[model samples]
Target chain A: MKYHGGHFICAVWKLDIRLWQLLIMASLLLAGVWFRDFSLYPAQIAFTFAAGLITQAIFLRLFKLEQHGFLSATITCFGLCLLLRSSALWVHPAVASLVMASKFLIRPQGAHLFNPANLGVVLGLSFFPETWVTSGQWGQDLTTALWLIAAGFFIARNAKRLDITAYFLLFYASLFLVIRVAWYGYTLPVFFHQFQNGALLLFAFFMISDPMTIPRHHKARILHAAVVAVLAYIWQYQLYWNQGIIWGLFWATFLVPLWNHLFPAPRYQWQALSGEHT
Target chain B: MTTRLIFLLLALSISQTSQAFCGFYVAKADASLYNQASQVVMTRKDDKTVLSLMNDYQGELKDFALVVPVPQVLTEGQIHIGDAKLFKHIDDFSAPRLVEYHDEDPCQPPVMYEKMMSAPMPTAAMPQKAKSDKSLGVTVEAEYTVGEYDIVILSAKESDGLEKWLQASGYKIPKGASAALKPYIKQNLKFFVAKVNLKEQNKTGLKFLRPLQFAFESPKFMLPIRLGMINAKGPQDLLVYILTEKGRVESSNYQTLKLPSNMDIPVYIKDNFADFYKALFETQVKKQNLRAVFTEYFWNMGWCDPCASEPLSYEELKQLGVFWLNQNSNAPQVMSGGGVPVQVTRLHVRYTPDSFPEDLSFQETRDTENFQGRYVLRHAWQGKPEQCEAAKTYFEQLAKRHEQEAKTLAELTGWELSDIKKKMNLNDAPDQESTDQWWKKIW
Candidate 1:
């Protein structure tokens, strides 16, 4: 989007998709707190931002990556606040700093390897015994799932990263259908019930469709998503580990560079100073 | 706040449970409440798990049979008969409690005081077998007689042979049991079949069947609910008590919600606590469309805030098969009387086969936050409203408080609002008439 002239609509049209992402995430958090009865506190959210933004600033100066902005950090903070739940207050801030630091530390080919929020959840669940991902906190409510999808459609449309989300959902639902519905004789409601999960939908639209961490080429991204689906199915169903959806993406991040090398394309940029889509 | 021990009625409902954890009480007995409600106490740490199934089979001993899927065949040493009293005590300890508080004199400054009318606080809280056959593609791995029960472990190649084998063995499984049993068979899970041994049952001379306890190690932390749904008349209720070393336990596949607690209700509910609770639970089940698991109580066994039937003692904990703690080396070093902070989470669910198609999968989370279904009752002082300025304020507050309590009860139980107001004598209250502008008061 570019500023064609000094018109209000043109200015609004020039808004980056990430700004919509930022607004949607904040609204979703509020909706979760109000409607879903999320067991989250304002202090935890405050601490997460306090830690995440500070870590982002320190890394920007320390690593001389000032070209990047705080939008991603803010979005990651919302993700962490939404996904990670802990009884202790300090776990929020501590994990926030570590996750923000990971964005800079765990990079390959000058791009972040793991989604910052995905890595946060993975590390928190793996290392901190006191922290956990409440996967079932978001019940399989149809209305909530639809709301996520509607919001996702609007935001992901502008980002032009809908392929991975679509691919991930297809592959994941196929695995679920084949195993639970077809092989195990579970009713189709059970299969559909699994997809109506708000957490899973949120992962599809917000987490997996993240343009930076995903492969640049379209085909490679789809393949990457399929790999995630299979690995996540094995991790959750076969290996019986908790939070396998996020762990699926966490494990698949190692293959991003390989996918990029296999099918090459230009790196994604959120901002083009001269205003270009690519 | 001064405490008043007026009534200690715990109205928490303990579902009379069996099934979907697998098998049926078979047939030809009173298929009523006990058939619909099944209770299981599962304790886990690491890969080790001990499951105690409460078999409240209110039927003839010959007809009572239970089939459950185990990850592997259990040896004779792995099975034992559990004390029925343990289930009762654990139920009472975890049931929702009603606490009462009396309003102090408004003229005097606030003072903290404690009063107890009774020494003991009351709470309302409230399984088996297997076999094998060959050439029918069913293999009976092992059989044993363990105290009033004949247990057989079966590994079936397919559900058809297993169903036939069970029927041939005089187990009288329900129709369509094969379809229900195929998933487990496909998963290669061994089924443990238990039947009441008439002679051994007679030797015990006890009317009720003792709980069946099994100790095993499996990485799959889940309970199969599909098989039990085959025997369902409508919606079945399941009550699970999870004891874990790390923290609270929640179903990974189903949403686990905490029941509304610590709310004030009308004083008349003290006597009608049981009916109140039943209505509240039904209302919640209906509201969630029978798709969620409700956490009634979650607290560490070391201590409780109001101390509902003294936290399970170390000996009692061991009896429940909590394997992480050692009796000798793990003595309490601090005031937390118990060792290794055992957390007990009570989960209840009401579901039909349609609503819940999959087995309940659970994961232990690192949440040590204490929660309980403690309803409060506030007793208004009998002083006249003309005594002092604070007295006038207290009387006004009391009327509004009563009104608020009435609304809460109606909302919580889905009761008729007018009927609740009639029960509280709230419609005729003079203060209600004084506030004619509803919009002005709402703000």
Candidate 2:
């Protein structure tokens, strides 16, 4: 194959990536409108579109992420959607927007910073005690569980962090068992409901799978994901009634950079012997 | 550094432990009109010292409970009344309860101190033989009930022999030997109980004895009289006077009368004296409009010299008389500056340490000089100015009287009259001029 001109490559790349970005945005808006509630459709749709474009622009500038990185952008957009929804549920819209804006200004390092949704909601709740964020609309039923598992698995596959995903699932399940035994008195249905509750499935898939912020090494990423899963499970089941996924995402993001620094990525050199078809 | 840290930790632990038990209560007592009944109860608790009052009545009650950790005996642990006291033991913890009355509105309950006013008088005869041999001297006995406790006061001459007796009898003479005796007597005094005569031997069940209620008179309304002692020892030179409203003898509405001589004494008071006095006065005023009459007796006679003597030169005495005349005389003379006719019944000079002795003597001499020189100088300087010009003419006549008397006394005492006149002439001459002229000079 002959090498293509730089402009031709750039135009094609932009067109393809923009199409994928638009698809991801539409899916997020539809999910917010349909699954969340018809009442919240307008606000959720508007906030998701604005937040997605703004966050993508911010991450592109801060991390120099390539235009073709549709998987990374889509994952981030989903995370932002969940954050806006959670913030709106837990705190006043104005306050949640203010908190989200604060995260952008304070730590602009994309997913490497504190998980925007979790930090914002926790801080908003702490600051405004009279407000409460709840997921009362999402019924704790089996249908919700299947929907979360499917979505989580799909996102996990797209991000190509299968080992990290598996580790998180095992860690969360084990933690749930321990918490159930210690505090709630063992019940299978309670455990299932706890796992399926509010944006947990969405967080597990989109938030936890941010490749740029997650460790590249398989073992390190698995361990980081496991820690995040355990923390999330404890916060949700043991602590009870909290933004557990937000905390989980924050811990995972925090640990990834530390793990990367400690265990540097393996370097691959170009092999001249490949010219001879060896 | 480690020692300091350990010490800090130790101090913190000690403070926390102490704070756990140190507490107090705010108590309120109410009594109804007609003195029919009363009720006393605490409102809130601080640590362990439950603030309570003593009253003789029956009613409903309300109070708050505060639990803490430190032992209640520490000095920092105080029940704040006007004068707070520390809780000596846990049993001292019971605060006064509201009295229960069946059918009457409760009156304001008597405060802890006022309860003393209602105590019955002690009988003239001694109830029991003196526990000590030296206790036979004059004893002043007083009894009063405060809250649920009875208080008595007994004053007897101090005797070493009594100390020995109490010691030999295994009685612990409490610390603060002299002060503790009053409470001891109050606690031990027994009341007489009447029994049914046993002439009818066939009385099946025991008949009851007549109940005896102690009779106590309310204290007279009195202001706190503070006597200041100047150059005397042992309260000898001190005289105290308490002035009060005419009809209310027991009411606290009276003021302390400050006599000219009282200014001589040095004033010293206990730390919470003001609070005690205020609480006392408030309680007395609530009962009735009150006043007090106080008289002082010197423990020693030597300090009475200044109080008894009258010292003034003849000319000085005349001037003193004239000064009083000036002060007592009405304005706008009755007869064209001829001096308004007035009777002088008494003229005397009063002195105390607070009074400047020098100023008194100077005033006396100035009045004696007849003010002749003053009038002459004023006339020469301004030719009869308005305002006080008529008074000046009257002062001139009084000065003439003083001059004659000063000379007479001077000759009789063999003193130089010139020296007396010279002193009298030293009074400051008045300056009278138009405001315009005065401003002209200033500018």
Model 2, range A83-149, lDDT digits (tens) per residue? 4432132223334344344544654323335544455555554564323333322433346557666
Q: What fraction of the native interface does candidate 1 get right in terms of contacts?
A: 0.53
Kindly list the per-residue Cα lDDT of model 2 for residues B1-443, writing each as its tens digit. 42453244233211111111111112211111113211111111111112222222122111111111111121211222211111111011211111111111112233332221100000111122223233444232333332222222333343233333333433334333332232213223211111112332124232221111122111111111111112212211111111111110111111111111111000111222233223332333222222211111111111111111112222221221212223433341233322222211111111232221111100000000000000000111222223355545645544454455445434333446565455445224222223337576786
**Cα error, candidate 2, residue B158 (Å):** 74
Poorly placed runs, candidate 2 (over 4 Å):
A1-32, A35-41, A51-78, A83-111, A115-132, A179-184, A266-278, B1-443
| Residue B114 C-alpha lDDT in model 1 | 49
Q: What lDDT score goes with residue B186 in model 2?
A: 28
Separate clash counts for every candidate? 19, 39
For model 2 chain B, where is the 10-residue window of minimal lDDT?
B367-376
DockQ by candidate, in order: 0.46, 0.00
Among these predicted structures, which one has the highest TM-score?
Answer: 1
Report the TM-score of chain B alone for all candidates: 0.86, 0.18
